[model samples]
Target: MNSSATPVAVDMGSSSVRVTAGSFDGARLTLSEVARFPNEARTVAGRLVWPLHELVERTRAVLSAVADEGMSSVAVDSWGVDHVLVDASGHAVAHPASYRDARTRGIPDELARRGLTAQGLWSRTGIQPDPINTSHQLVATLRQLAPAERDDVARVLMVPDYVAHRLGAEPGWSRAICSTSGLAEPGGGRWADDLLRELAIPTEWFGDIAPERQVAGHFAGSSDVPVIRAGSHDTACAVHALPSAPGPRVFLSSGSWSLLGVETDRPLLDDAVRAAGFSNEVRTEGGIRLLRNLTGLWILQECVRQWTREGVPTTWAGLTRDAVNAPGATALLDPDDPVFQTPGDMPARVRDAVRRNGGRVPESPGEVARVVLDSLAVSYAGTVRQLANLTGANPSCVVAVGGGTRNDLLNQLTADACGLPVAAGAAEATSVGSLLAQLETLGEIGPNDRSAIVDASFDVRLYEPRASALAGLAPPNLERLS
Candidate 1:
């Protein structure tokens, strides 16, 4: 294994795409950023869709920037569920629809109409039934297409798989991410055959399912450097980068969507798991990620976008500082509310939700930021408790990773709300984990020791739960809403 070769990790997130180069000297891994660019869904012909060609172009530009850096290999990971439909010639049939698109609005009711329930699906696939899941999206696609058009579909590739295919890798599905489709069987590479038959989906639409850490192929022009299948699912990669000793520790991959969960050797498939709103997604390493998807920093991110559109461009640090001293929990709206999921006038929506909840409406940008952060913390706290109870694993601490960890206010509030210490670090976790998985595939590092390598590679900022922050705020009782 040549430690001098710097491997590349491409993280295609919902909001942005980032590339990192990692230098591993057979002992420690050091990561450096190569490129970053914003990615947004576009409204074309009255439909919201991902700019697939534009994304491919940006990724190529990023890869080109590091093409001369003695690059050993490259791997990619992306947000889960959404995929592209390709024809027999490997051309995308159409622009991929946004996960938040309204096409699948009545999918749950449709499933019920067919006598297929969430519990029935969960028991077989271990995926919680979400309208945004690829299964529902495929259904929408099928309904939108004529029977002749449906016959033209050859493959359905998830976002990262599509990106990886463009990089000259074999067209294969990463089970780590495919698990989120609500179609794959838990802890296995096989698809849920019965579910697929029931939904009238062609089993041949999916190609070979690849396990994590395998070399898919070489980059398009390079023969020596292998492109590894490193989780492919962004949250799976982020969880792989966690620097924790073998112990009871919860992980919160906080970003646009806060996926808070724990890793287990087997899927927790039960009625309680479904009732608790926790999803059992497959892990990069061999296990299940029992977690809940809480609406995360997206509310605040949208608010910033709105303010910038109104000629008040602001940085996250600037907004955090402004809200740091603002009143806490004066208004608390459920961050997971359906209205907040779609993109729009977020600041106004936050204010309206707060007012509707009998709390004071945010009159300023700072107040709006504070309300969003406080609401997110409240949701995180409640989800953590539910995760613990469902899994029966009382973790000693919560490991917060990704972009949201930099927000001091949210970290402290989460710690206070959960009554547990928080260790936040690895802001570039998804990329780092991708690189680590690549390293393991190249035999530069052992598979079992990847966690220890991560533990020694990065620094962590610790926060102890402070009772003062939770003094007056009432923790969100989601159960009461049920």
Candidate 2:
């Protein structure tokens, strides 16, 4: 099999590294799987850190298989906000702690005491102030380290950059992902030293944030297989596949996490957005990504995992169907409740929450699954409305992407909940977006050509909202009004 006719893409996620190859015949690209490696996080010394060295090894091993199979070019991308600091020798100084670790607690307050208040930070950098941000983690880690070791650190490459470095290349600080760390100057592409200083972050913790689609570097060992930055941020890559063209549109990448927002020409950082939990992140072309951090499938996945462990098989499909058939809004949950923050005893917690909310605890697998899915869709509906109120951009439709899109129940719930059309498909939105950037980087396509390209390669699932289904959000004293 002569492999000269295909191209490939590499995607790094919080849990796995996947690569796919495709042939671009001037119109659309047809992709083939190259590899998937076991990638996950671990608790090291009580902190959750991604297995960095192991991740790189698996990524290279997977891509190398594609290299061996033959490919024209490769582009790399991953989840943003977590980084591994490499000494001048390009070796990680310490395991990169997981953003979910408890160590990040109070760092937000520490930044404020140091005079990096929410307003000050946003006015200076435009990033939303959140404890889970990399800046907070960097500060928390620095507090743990001896001051001497901090200054000697050479490169603070985000995870993707770290992997790229080991791939025998100069890692890039991509704009797409950098914006997520709450350190970048929001709509701006460059890192702001003044903001870092105010936040007390060392200059060495970050690199120049660049648009990955423009720069080219050779794969460390394979000169014939050069790699492009390709947006470098997984969420941005996911948004790249959303059906956004010629109108106000929102892309909701609902997976283990739910990213709900609209692409903006500028940052929306007013009191409205701030109060509603909306963040302004930068997109691939330096576009503003006004979204929120909504705890998504974690609840359902956790509950399902727990039930299965307890001898009850609860598939998402089975659960969602039960919810669709069950009574609507019998219980409402604070989906962002701190209890839901970390994993453990999700089913119990859900039962407790239902009991606490004056509702009966779910007694069966179907009831539990139904509650989880309905809650997620309701959360999405509420979030969509809030985003619109924050940015004043009432998007006509919601473009639902990623693995969560496969949930027809959740998709319909969102449609009925928000009373807006939902376009869901390309369960591989993140990878496809990654591949889209790869295609652009290879000069086989243009970025703005996304609409036609996506239409050709994907089957868009559209769900129209019925005025009658939105009654779920009200006081329940009334029926859904169209």
Candidate 3:
């Protein structure tokens, strides 16, 4: 233990919750992990429940562990859109809904019938409007439930705020996290009242939350902890993990969904981008994470899950290795195809997507794996080019971060397709980011310090793009096989 004081930042995700303790040392940050909890949404009696009480128990347990470790302060952040409904007594009124549910589909269309444009929504929220957004979900809730239950609902706060309330602290919610809720404004830190009213969502459901730069509130966890808003958005925390490249760069946080995009100072709401499945997620410092959400390795993961269920003994590592050795790619699926969105028969859907696009379907698990990886690389290249055009920042390098960067095949394919150097690895990018954002929140790190610390702690690899692949990046397919 460093004899020096420390602060803890908590990052809560759909899958897990993490507590990292540290303070920046100007040039670098010293971080240590305290605890992690297995988290997932469960459906009981046909309602998706977050197990908020259990999560709080875990949070206190982790903080108790951190206290035992002698760490100083603590903070919290979680995935966006889902929120806890608080009753007048300040107790949780209802369990938060997961974004993965199918209920939000028709609300946007229904609202559009009432003259609400998604483009207008983009400009207001500076966020890509998705049906799974909180506003849309709320509308769906109204349509499905009794008016009395809806009337009984009082205040609503996102996940982190909900946790803060349990800690007996004045919930200082983070607007940065709120920005991704598809309900909050993208550029402005305030909630978009007009959009809320237009969607017929109760404007009073939300409360004032500060931007990421400001310290939200204090959490008295063993110590008087200042709970900073550390880029309350999970993706924002993950992006913070990417090394600060010298020039412009596109980062692919590949996992269940490939978050592909470049960071921008302004929102890109042009109809073409919107039509192309692009949306703006907020960055930590109020920038727009101009991105397109592609169904990424989740298909590969599900394929493996099914294969394992069938006793084929496939794993992520094994699949990646086999995919690298597999002969070639026969076809590609536009990553945003809705067929691959939900959980069900993934392989069949993959084959169908390829077949419909006039592409060859895979015969074996290896081919299907190759098909998915190669298509991701191709998609990454296309997104990189679009990001450069959209931001006018010619990124000479594409930074592939997150767990998927370990795949040698995908990295090299991305390098070749984009004709740019691919810097891959730092598999713990999201964790580091979540931690660093906390350190920054505690007044220990600044923007300049963030770059230096990441450069020192992370082992980053680079793969140069092939000239042959650049030639094929024309209006048509000159695609490079991963």
Candidate 4:
């Protein structure tokens, strides 16, 4: 790699795709977004599927545009679980199913009917038995295909890996993203063969898991720029940018989902952990990210969408301001409530949920938004306490990352609810972490230098807890919503 070369991180998020270029000086790493575009899955032939071809073309254009700027390498990171099936020629056999697709809706129950209980699956994969899991999605897909068509399914690549392969990287599963699929052994970087056999999924479709930071091939096939597997899973990449702190580090990768958990040295597969809906996902540097995948900003986003459709558009800034001034939420919702799962009529659904829970129904949009924000904070606090109990390590503070950190009301509420100071920043955490991984892999920075660079490069604001704010909020009880 040239000394002045820049590494670009292609962050493929569920809602958007961002391509950012990073230049690291001796002390600070400066990042600038080269391109960004909206990314969303749409109904294609009665199934919700990602715009894989469009995404690939957009990413390729961005990379090509930046290729002449002394680029050293490029890496891709994206949301986990969703994947694309490819043929021998490396072209997608079909558009990748969105995790939100209803095809996997009852697959878990179907699996249980076959004697593959949720606990059994968790024991093998250390992943929560969610229908959104890749294993369940594969089961649904395989059951839908005829025997002859199934033969055409040559490889199952997670979204990032598939994108990288399309961009000229070698065909290989990146470890961090593979770990999210519920098909691989927790923290082991190997496919769970026993589980695959039990699920009747073809074992040949998967390849060896590649390290998070390794050169797979050259970008665009003929370019000198290398395509690195730098923390392929978005959460793993975000966690990579975490500033070093003592004791167990609790982090909230707040986005469409509120992934709240602490880093562990190994998978915690005990019954208690599973019972609490916790999953042991793999970290980029090799460890278990023991966390609960909770519902996050999706509800609010859905509400905004519906409002816009109803001829009343709402902006994030206005919504946050309204939520701040609104009265306390009369009812606390379990963000994971099934009612809020799918998009459409979100405000009405929120009111229905509150009514069902015997709480006052919110009449206005601000009130509805307040209910969601309050509920999320309460849930965050509860999850943090659960992490401490399960791991036996008291965290010093809560680290909140991703787009959700921009909401000051939610950040302060989380601090108050968790009863801990919240260090919130790195709005582009996934991209930052991917860049850090690329820089480290290219020998531009040492392993220990990530924290210092992150601190110097980003503006992390600390929100102190205000216990008084918790007075009107209801206690967290995940079971009530379940």
Candidate 5:
């Protein structure tokens, strides 16, 4: 690797794709955004599908631009589950379906009707059953595809892997990202052969799972720049960037979805863990991240979207200020309510949920936002307690990372609700982690040096718990809420 080489991280988020370039000055890493593009799935022929060609073109343009700026190595990470199917010639068979598509609406139930019970599947994969999982999506996809169209499918790659494959990497599945698909075995060792056999999915579509931090191939147009596998799952990449600490680590990768979990040496497959709504995913550094995937800021985002469409656009600062000044919430919501899952009149659905739960309905946007935030805080606390019970490790502090860390009110509320201090930072954690992995692979940095680099590179805000805020509130029963 050149001493002046710059490594890049491509973070493919559900809402946007960000390309960040990193410069390591021996002791610390400095990052800058080189490109950002809106990434949204659209309705095509009455089905929701990702704009695969457009995304690839934009990404290639950005990577080519960075190549001209002395790029070294690059890696890509994205949300998991959704995948792309390609023919023998590596051409995509069709646009990848969005995880939010309605095709998977009753696939889980359908699987159960076919004698594959949730418990049976969980025991095999150690993944929480969800309609959006790749297993369910594949089922829905096969059911809708003509037999000839299905036969043309020679390979299936997770979104990140597909992107990397298009960029000249030898076709392969990164282990960290593969774990997100319920079709993989625990810790992403291999495909669950028995499960796939029962699901009737062709085993040929999958290949060997590749470990992270290894060079896959060179950039398509630039042989000097290696495309590395730096943790393909976005959450795994974010967790990789966390400052190394000694005790039990509880992290909240807050974003559109809030993933609350702790790292463990192995998957926790107990029925209690499954009943508690937790799933075990593989980590970039080897091990399992036992987490509860809860609905996070999406509710608030939906509320804001509704307001904007109603000719009453609201800014984040103004909404937060108003929420802070508004009266305390008289009603609390289960943010994971299915009614709030899809786009539409979110505010109305929130009110309906409150009313159905026998609580006072919130009429104003500020009040509604307050309820959502408070409810999330309570849910976080409950999940923390559940973690303690499930793992028997006392968490030292709550480390909040990603976009939601910027919300000071929610951070403080989380601290209070959990009765623990909160350390928030690394808003671009996915990029940071990806950069670290790239540098390590290039021999510019070592594993033990990541903590020092993170400490030098970012500012961490600490929020102390305010015991008074927990006076009358209890961590809502998460099991009941779901």
Candidate 6:
């Protein structure tokens, strides 16, 4: 295989697994999508868990196809926090629990009983004490295990690392994603040993944390190809893929979850940031991602899924089109409402939330979709403003990447609510960022010129706020309406 042939980038999201082969010549870069497979969680005994073996099979099939293309390197990235517990021989003790599982529903109260307050956690890890965090999930799992079963576990690997291990790569953890565990020291990538000691989680269970772009191993069949450590966390890779030059611009990686934040040279550990629900996850490029994880398109996705199950199928484009034309500000719900976190009866929940908040109950699918889009935009707008306020960043525009970029209505509403322009595109941002990391690690893309090259390689859609939408914000009930 030629050393210059582009690497294969595998991005495994909660909803889908996408594989792309990129060819980056000095002048231009061409990315071709090779394979895409739905990556759904299985309902095992009423608990949502990732089907690791099936996912591994699907990934191998994709990699096998790319092996014949003379590819010399592969980079894999996925959603953070969720991990698999394996024995010394690398067999999974149990299926990996999806973050949406309710096992950790009472973790916050449990931690509180142990005198581990949210302030203590936020100050130590710079992560919000969310039940979805790996630490909480690990504790929840341990509580259900027999003493013998717990002793059999030798190692834990995050989703992306586990996939790489199945592909013959050295099993390890990435600091960028480990920060999402709510166990890493703030501003530093080191695992928080004190907190781990408090929780009685042996540090050895987690392998050594490696920096991004480190070579893991080679594909099983393709011995010559290297498996590069991309930012294991999908959002970290997406942030790296931003086409803009390094500046104080708000980066919104919207997908199943809308992670809105600012990139700063340092982590924001102030009381205000913590109170505002901001997290400081480690960035791949030695920075900090001061962001908040908002309940993104998941609520709307669940509604669509439920509707399809009931024989009323619709696509995202159709939903967005209907939402764009629906009357604005008629209904609204906070995207972070806990009731909408789990799957099932999403439309009913949305209606319930709206009515509880003193808004009209949406009766139609389009109206429900509008409520979701408008609420999401308002969430984005509020987060953007908070980012500027807390970090003293004066961002001129918001840069949105990932699948949510296709939602033009959401983007425009965000602009209207935040009073800032939005530049959105690069739907396959995590893959692009993973590819860039692989290329940069291989010395193909110079550090000094990387941002410029990415900017030239991709396109951006500009959205400016509409006055009508902004005017609707004056009403207390329709603050997110614009």
Clashes of 1: 0
CA deviation > 4 Å runs, candidate 3: 1-5, 22-26, 47-49, 220-223, 467-482
TM-score, candidate 3, is 0.89
Task: Give candidate 5 misplaced runs (Cα > 4 Å).
Answer: 1-3, 468-482
Which lDDT tens digits does candidate 5 get at residues 120-163?
88989999999989999999999999878898999999999999
Q: Which scores higher on lDDT, 2 or 6?
A: 6
TM-score (C-alpha) between model 6 and the true structure: 0.96
Minimal lDDT window, size 10, model 1: 473-482
Q: What would the per-residue lDDT of candidate 3 be over residues 385-408, giving only the tens digit for each residue?
A: 766666678886777777678777
Q: What's model 3's lDDT at 169?
A: 54
lDDT of each: 0.84, 0.74, 0.71, 0.86, 0.87, 0.84
Model 4 TM-score relative to the real fold: 0.96
Worst 10 residues of 5 by lDDT: 473-482
lDDT of 5 at 243: 68
Q: Estimate the overall C-alpha local distance difference test score of candidate 1.
A: 0.84
Every model's Cα RMSD, please?
1.8, 3.5, 3.4, 1.9, 1.9, 2.5
* Model 3 lDDT-worst window of ten: 473-482
Pitting candidate 2 against candidate 4, the one with the higher lDDT is 4
User: What TM-score goes with each of the models?
Assistant: 0.96, 0.92, 0.89, 0.96, 0.96, 0.96
Q: Please provide, for model 2 over 52-143, each residue's C-alpha lDDT reduced to its tens digit, 9 standing for 90 to 100.
A: 78777777777777778676777777776788877888888888888778898888787777767777666656666777788888889878
Task: Indicate whether candidate 5 or candidate 6 has the larger TM-score.
Answer: 5
* Runs off by more than 4 Å, candidate 2: 1-5, 146-152, 244-247, 321-325, 467-482
Model 4 score (lDDT): 0.86
